[model samples]
Target: MQAASFTGILKAIFYMIAFYYIFRFLAKLFLPLLVKKVVEKAGQKFQQQQQHSQENPWNKTTAKDEVIYNTANTKNPRETKKVGEYVDYEEID
Candidate 1:
């Protein structure tokens, strides 16, 4: 079995530090551009939703609609008519 030497350990540490700095530089260079693109996409989506709502009125119903019911205003009482005949049932065991 080959044991790792001090030089190999130092090289690994250096490579890790180099990779960390490289990733940090890349994030600094591209993070703002990515964020800007995301914000622009969100704005465009919101505008499209607004325009769609404006175009179609069916999507604009709020929670405050008032329901009105009109009843009959007759002076006399409503005459009730008989509807059905009652049936007698017998059970056998």
Candidate 2:
């Protein structure tokens, strides 16, 4: 096995720096295109969802289909119950 040399270390560092710069350049060129396509796809999906909601039968209601709840005829379920006797307490300061 060969021992590690200063030249070898320098070469490895150079390669690492070169790789980092190249990766950054490629990412700068491609990342925006990828992001734009993803955003467009998401926007299309959102538009499709909006269209689907607009076209949905359940979302449409006519005046005759409206429901009116008569709360005046219904008795209150939570009537006042006498759980305990009221106590009058006087505090002296």
Per-residue accuracy of model 1 over 21-84 as CA lDDT, tens digit each: 9999999999999999999999999999999888987946788888875556456667889898
Clash count, predicted structure 1: 0
Look at candidate 2 and give me any clashing residue pairs: none
In angstroms, the error of model 2 at 85 is 14
Query: For all the candidates, what are their Cα RMSDs to the real structure?
Result: 13.0, 5.2
Give the per-residue lDDT digits (tens) of candidate 2, residues 10-85. Answer: 9999999999999999999999999999999999999999999888968576767667998965876667878999
| Candidate 1 residue 74 C-alpha distance from true site, Å | 24
Off by over 4 Å in 1: 59-93
The runs of at least 3 residues in candidate 2 whose Cα sits more than 4 Å from the true structure, single-residue gaps closed, are: 60-93
